[model samples]
Target chain A: MRVPRPNRAQLGAGALVLAALSVGRVVTEWLPEDPSPVRAFERTTTLDREVHLRYGNLRVTEVDGGKQLATSTSAMLSPGLWVTAHVDFTPTVDKVGPAYAELRDGEGRVLTRGSRNVLECKVINPGISGHCLVAFEVDPTALAGSHLALTVNVNDQRGDDMAVVDLGITPAQVATWKARTTPVELLMPKDAT
Target chain B: MAPVGMDGGTDSLRATGRWGRARQWLATLTVRQWLLAAFLLVLVGSSPFGGLRAQRAEATPTLSVGVEQTVAPVRLTVTKVRFGSDLGVPQAAKIDGRYVVVFAKVTGTDEKRSVPMYDALRDLLRIEQVPGVTKPFSTDPEPSSDDLRPDTILVADDAERMGDLAPGLTYTLAFVWRQAPGQPVPTSVRVAAYSHTFRQASIDDTYDWRDATRAAVGTFPATAYEKPAAS
Candidate 1:
């Protein structure tokens, strides 16, 4: 009868593997409930080192990678208007997930919840990047002449992980847009600003 | 049934193990694998990898809480200048082809989750604190006083086209908590009044929220309605 022979190399390898396995287990179990849903990503940012939040990539482009707006349309937005974000989600298998955007009011009130969806990719692949056309209506009644902030979440499934992006509403531009372009036929806010 | 069959079974098992490991690595990250190993380590108490991964898995199911706002104040910062040409009426008297985009972020630390981002925002904005002392700044403790709403908020001349305001430029906007009162104001502030100059425009800007970032202040700046002179 030959007893199972364990060489030093095998023994060392076994020990390392065991150690790694144990650490993983402890960490997972220890992570608090609802562990940080945000998956760390090393992408571009518009924030300084002090800022923990930044918009990675939520630029707008016509479908099929169309030309960007020649000049920013910062001067024409008015209160009570609808703006469509031709959001293009990516690389993830889900082209369209639970898509939605958030809007907060001057008083930290949530003015809107724009649903986000990977309109083109959910059913196809979980890792394939896709796009979603999210619709968000600007808040016309915020305490300030306009509201700020737009956060988006795109996911493949309901409970599965989600991709988030933060965007800041251009205030001066919004104000300028509101004052210059509002039409007459449509009763607009009284000339207050 | 025979020695030959037994040898074949052993070979198959070894092949299966190798394939499984490779596939697992592809699907998960190194840290994840390490975590798995550790959990299993603890789960089984010891198994080379100590089955730490298994142990962790068995420890407890994290309570996932989707952070978002069920109801929040009407906050939307978007600006686009619409010329009369865009509105098919140079003197359309209102903004017409304009677009403003808002951006925000949400972090989840709760135990259970569902649409965490939106949910958390809604919750935070809705049913604010009880001002005066524990909730002083609220001004009014009532619902209407706080301006908290669940659906979309609009501060336009009309409610029908609330989501589609007449395109125009030079209007006060909302900045829930992005920049601040005056410091770091938006890139450019439209200073014209009903001047149909630029049309079909979009402003890539953000609202004032420096105070919020500091977690020291509230009262974000937004486009307030400068009431009409009692027409």
Candidate 2:
């Protein structure tokens, strides 16, 4: 016939529990889905053709690497080889963000520019074309048929529109490059030749 | 039927008595006691949210212009602000309104590594037309007298000029902001440089611009403005 009322302390505790559950639920529901590191992206077999992206077109001219790492001042040795891609960017957007390179090997090993030494060229303006070198220091053995993924507007953190360039390096080509690897002089884009 | 009616009446009386007793209990507390109880309730109510946050000290002072402001690898100086109507620029280069050009110098202070000065510079340099709001305009929106690279903060190096700073180098750069159509040109403006950690996602791109250490380069009066003939 009678109902027992909860005291202030008990009511407050219940409210606190409810808020905690709500906050937890929102966090779980709103967090971005983790991208699969091994997931396949749209692949471009050729690099010279204009690869269209949301902001602009990119033409990756060359992708090369071996054991030798060279700078103007000195040459350094690495446990793995360096992979460099010379890319030309033509912007179509007003505020263009920076782009980074990722290297994925057949064994599912992935390496980003953050993980290795690199010299990058930035394309920030839309009025003129820009060139950048996105390099990654990766395991020399992984060079056999690895994919060099270039994602533009990387700072936007949207994580879409990646141009995956297949390195197309055969095991024999890797062997030849390894045997003939020479110390490369790190030069400015103008002095790259 | 008679017993059911009696039971219903008893239940109603019991509910009324319970509420009356609750109100009587509340009335017995003095004003000071009531205030204390209310404060305690608020404190307990906020405990879950408040307890989670670590207490932080006051924020760092904002950096001012005419002074060299350093944030780790990058050191910036905002030297001057100039306003122009036509700017003697090419027709294609002209904006819908006017141009407020800011001249600043950035140097890479770190000897160990080359700072991505362009990314930091873009994020740090801003024109404060109003007090708090910073307008986002395209940097070097159009072609100009100086041969400027679209992506670079530097003009194509002439016989005398050096471009964006390499490590241990200081380079002077200009940023151009356009006045919105129908908006009066700002008579007085403040140029500000922000200090932030050099992350791949740039300070401006990732965090709130206010959170960074803001250094006001300088405030300029109307006399500093320049007017050039439009093509």
Candidate 3:
């Protein structure tokens, strides 16, 4: 019995296959394992306009800021300005409210209600509007051109509806808010309108 | 030509090639030479994988009291160490044993988001050299189990439990450890501060500060236990 040697063409084909496999492996290794993309569906609206969410409707009725914020028991002073958003949530399907609320400044820095001593939105049944005040202690420099984001998804907001309300804060407004020395009262969340 | 003759000629030519001559030389090696060659090959191969490299352990920084240490996402300064029956906090009233309270000023360094104090500062300091205060899992025989975590962390001025630490705001925090009733009070306490890396978790790709490692160590003299003056 005789063993046959590989011909030039056969060797070339084998080398090509090996090179292709090596290139493919390198490309796949360089590719990201998890390319997490933004998945939230944002419904933007101006102040006093309602934005429809998947389970409810959100509206920023009023925006106020001052140097001091007075809670039910005591008042707290801020190193910077304290901006509070009076929000109204009307649930359409189930008992839901904005569990996640934050203030995003022009520089893209976010201040969430969890960071401040503020009241959270109370989840109410369908058909009635729930009123709540979401407060954020922000740097006075970041007060201008800041927006409020409210979402019902508490844990993860991916693939969910988020309400983005333009606070319409201007430089003059930020200056006025910073100059005000009086403490703004922080009210608790009301169950129904 | 006959098949056998052709095969013999091919074999002779192949044996004279570079690799074939090298193989013949290897076959002629004595046992000692072969062992030496094998060891040399292993030493050269292991060099790239760092197996033969010298272990260089980094010296942890020794920080003095009142000096600030930045451990990423937060800066901590051990301000004072005192022994007292009460920490001026509501929860301290119920805790009867003597408390070794360490007052530290913590400032959040992250500019973009608020860092939760529980996750960021809990493992930042470990209390050591305290009598009768055995660390959790101390009997496990693991070296890491020798770390004695703080009993509770609270806002120093307000006496409230610390929550999230906002950026650029400095808060004085009280890290308390309860001393056993019968054990003699320690004259001095050694404290270790840890550093952390902010990275995405393997389980859930969310980014967070993790992997706490000892960064600084300090020993402070324990003051005499004093009762608080009436507020």
Candidate 4:
């Protein structure tokens, strides 16, 4: 005579597992630690770029944050990145002091030694005014699909916060996915309370 | 009144015989098959699932979200921000009112949404009363801020970009939840403003900061940017 396998017990265990899966789904929503919206994220970034500067005539226009939508281009690279930010300012007040500007990577590592100069402006709106223009460049070693965060450092006061923007190296049709995600605000009349 | 037909005893016996046949047939069915038949009968039955569904419903409670809707307008405030070398603000301001980008995050169970700065400011967004133009541009997002909300179309002649908005112009935006239609419209938003400041003149002794400002002036950067809500 041969010993029989406990097929009935095996069936009972399988049934229990199925029941657990069902109940687990029921309670998933109640978990507090879950990330609110479902997102597609990678384990490590391929590319990362950042820009920084300070306030005054030399680098007047600060764009604390901007956005870049996903591109339809090939996203197979380990890390590929590119960012272009332009700012223009008029220096009406000539400052005898030399100002410095440079771009920094996410790790707080300086990508390039900063360069600077003075502005020429005759019009003074506040204490004084001058004209100036500046641009920040980043290394293309970051993930193309990842976000760009940058800051401007001048004097001792660094940019108050990070300006966030998205990168759209993907195809144009992906623009639709981005458009749908934008917010629609409900505002009051100018004169309303 | 007795007709020649049949006796009461015969009629009673015939009815009892039919009931007996049905009971016998039901008894012959396998236990599993019998249970299946009972389930089917419950499905199409008039008494409504009998009892099984009631227990399941109690154990699996769910909130029906995105069902109701409210057209109620939500109010939000946007400052008339203009920064530049002249602005002397810690941060530079674009002609369209500085702050190239802003990220707004809302909390609570209701959920938060993101819109372009111009779209968020549409309602309260005014052009500071310019002359020459007979009618001003409408303060509405062309692509619409609401994903599911209907769009209010504008004529081609009336189309304009966010760059057209100037500083000193005030604007407000509205928000409403359709699924929660019964909820009241948000009247006002408490705004908290903070600015990051830094300094750098574009002139590398040789770089022409003046020429750059001159170029930026008059011309406009009409790009629109929206930040995703933080998860």
Candidate 5:
């Protein structure tokens, strides 16, 4: 006729199972999928101005490339409409991957550096600041409203953290860049000038 | 002290008997039974299957020739393979072994998705001398025929590479690998393209190509190695 009460062992087991389930749910909810949670940290900054990123500060020192750099007389790279930028970047912390540059067209299409082009700006190490040049081959038409983006990705365990800056370019400037055919040296951090 | 109606001595004896029986039953268990119990306990204690799945997800899958496969935006096909010292380009340096020339055709399969331009170097394209083996020969590609010379061996560093490919556009890429002089010519060669995938809007954001279980394009019987000296 008396009601029963759960003793210590039974209550302890129940608490343990509930704890395990709570931990499992938290873990499953935290796991990332296609649109990863890490992408939420992706930040884009405007160029020619110093933009503070989680890892570093980046500024476009100069942007050069055009018909001249790609011409037969001083063909620094393969025959294409190429645009190159001089960047000054300083990493405040240890960044994981190489720093890379991407060029986007007026229509928001992306243009990577030509596969064979020699000029590539690499990532700078923490405490080491220097000059580097990044180049990309793009259709001449994209020059007018194109944006040159520079990014340094942080390889954090939880998700990826990247600092990106977009520098707007002009068509007349691209036309002028096409005429500077002399090959600019690609200077990576720790490389001998 | 004893309850008015219950006999405390009898209840104590029953409890002792129950404890003895339980101990005896456990002691009777064989080593095999103990091991099986431990295995089940481990299985229930910590499930490791979830960690295994997480590991497999990050593992990069290899890409191969002839197979019409899509790792999102990039669809690759190895149309023809030729092996000879002088098929595509003359070697710049005399070597003991022959050359393996692979001709691959690549296209963007999806308009919404885009991948980084394929580079023979960056894509990690290499040929396995024996099919399915992990041994990768130092490989380079002649993306264009302009640099090939009949009289001279082509410089590996000077090899041209394919450019960034957009949707609705296709490019045929040529790759070259050297088989060292004394090594037995591979009975069959497996071509692998270790490429990365990215979205068009976030082209810089990249992910390794996975999804397909097998990275190998269909393996083809090796072309007989004709020693250049014989020719």
Candidate 6:
């Protein structure tokens, strides 16, 4: 038995189909997964206003900065500016507190709270408000237009609720904070009246 | 048939030109000769750029003490090294043997995120000539060996553990190691600094700094620790 060979037009059609399949495969293989569409839900507010999260409500009662920070027994001098946020947290549904806290600068650089400063508010039961001070040692140059990000998730923030509070720090305030040499006393975290 | 240049000759005649010559030439070779020719072609193609020879790795640079060395995400400068029964830190009281303390100024170099000091700075420096000190081994089951790492990394001023380092902030850190008893205290010791590469992990796609390579080595003299006078 003899087999017929493909003609020129038939061969061209077959090659075109193979090329299209290869292009489709390349497109599917190289396309990136879009994680931005499922990013954390942000509740943005200014200082002194309460922002509701999925598990609790947070309010930044006060914001201050200085060149030195002092606790009850110990004090530390900052290499840069030290900004402290006084926050009041009241849980509604479940017992939750901000496990992850960071200061986001104007360039979007994040300065996380270090483990040395033990001033952050601990998790409390639902209803009663707990107050705490969260401190961040940030670069003096990155103080303008900074925001504080607080979340319940410790490691991963994807598909979770986050509270982004604007600190309302101006360039003038940054200049003054950078020049101040006095130490700011850090108060202990306690139950709010 | 028309002349060759007039209409490019007939199809069957053209087919007999190039393909016919190739077929005839292939038919003239013996099977052994054909195999030898194929082997020679592969050998020449595989070694296009001296691939058969071994490559020599460059030696790590030896830097002097107090010179800043970058190990990625942090720049370190070894300021001083001291040895004594009491190094003034709280851990010194608990340790049975003397403490070998190394003072360094560490600055965070990564701008986008804060780098945690936990085990990050421990893998960067290795002290030599310490008797019975646990050395870091890559094949060990533990991700990082605590025995080889510093017992504690404390801040020079407050004596607290140096935690996460923010960018552009320099911290005066004291890396403490308990000296193994029954060994003669050396007057000087060699310190090796390592560099790391930032890459995605194979198990999880998280990015981290890993694969430490010795970048710089230095020798520094150790001195007796003295308690600073109260202010």
Top candidate on TM-score is 6
Per candidate, chain B TM-score? 0.19, 0.50, 0.74, 0.23, 0.47, 0.71
RMSD of 4: 23.7
Give every prediction's interface RMSD. Answer: 16.4, 13.4, 7.1, 21.4, 9.5, 6.6
Clash-forming residue pairs, model 2: B63-B215, B65-B216, B65-B217
Q: What TM-score number comes out for model 5?
A: 0.47
Off by over 4 Å in 1: A1-84, A105-107, A114-129, A140-168, A180-193, B1-231
The residue ranges of model 5 lying beyond 4 angstroms of the native Cα positions read A1-8, A11-58, A61-83, A88-131, A137-147, A151-163, A169-193, B1-67, B71-73, B86-94, B108-158, B161-171, B182-212, B219-231
- Candidate numbers sorted by DockQ from highest down: 6, 3, 5, 2, 4, 1
Estimate, for each residue in B1-231, the C-alpha lDDT of model 5 and write its tens digit: 333235556867677777777877887887778889998887776675652223544544444446665544466676656565444323223444565666666665544323444332234345543321211333333333222221111112223344455334355655555544444556566665544444223465345343323234355556743434423
List, residue by residue over B1-231, the lDDT tens digit for candidate 4: 223234554655666666777776776777678779888787778356454455442221111212211111222222212111112211221223212211111111111111112222222122211111112232222222212221111111111112111111112211211111122222221222211111233643221112111000011121233322445
Per-residue CA lDDT of candidate 1, range A22-127, in tens? 9999997887643234343323222111112233223333211111111121222332444333443333332334344443333454433423111221222444
User: On DockQ, who's better, 2 or 4?
Assistant: 2
Q: Model 4, A1-193: lDDT tens per residue?
A: 2234669889899999999998998787665542223322211111222222232232323221112212122111101121332333332333322233333343233322222111112233433433322222222332233233333333331324333334333334233323343322112223221
Mind giving the per-residue lDDT tens digits that candidate 6 earns over A1-193? Answer: 1234799999999999999999999997887744233578989999999998888999998888888888766677777788888989998888878888878987788776668644467556899887767888888888888899988887887788899999988989888888887887778654454
- In the order shown, what is each candidate's alpha-carbon RMSD? 24.0, 14.8, 6.5, 23.7, 12.1, 6.7
Alpha carbon lDDT of each predicted model: 0.30, 0.55, 0.75, 0.27, 0.52, 0.75
Tens digit of lDDT per residue, candidate 1, span B107-146?
2221111122232233233212212111222322232313
Please compute DockQ, using alpha carbons, for every candidate against the native two-chain complex: 0.02, 0.04, 0.24, 0.03, 0.12, 0.36
Q: What is the interface RMSD of candidate 2, in Å?
A: 13.4
Candidate 3 residue-wise lDDT, A68-173, digit = tens: 8777655666666778888888899999888887678766776655544464675568988787777777777767888888888777878889988999989899
| A85 Cα displacement, candidate 3 (Å) | 2.5
Q: Which lDDT value does model 5 have at B178?
A: 55
Q: After superposition, how far is residue B137 of candidate 3 from its true place, in Å?
A: 15
TM-score of chain A of each: 0.37, 0.68, 0.79, 0.25, 0.58, 0.78
TM-score of 2: 0.37
Q: Is candidate 2 or candidate 3 better by DockQ?
A: 3
Chain A of model 1 scored by TM-score? 0.37
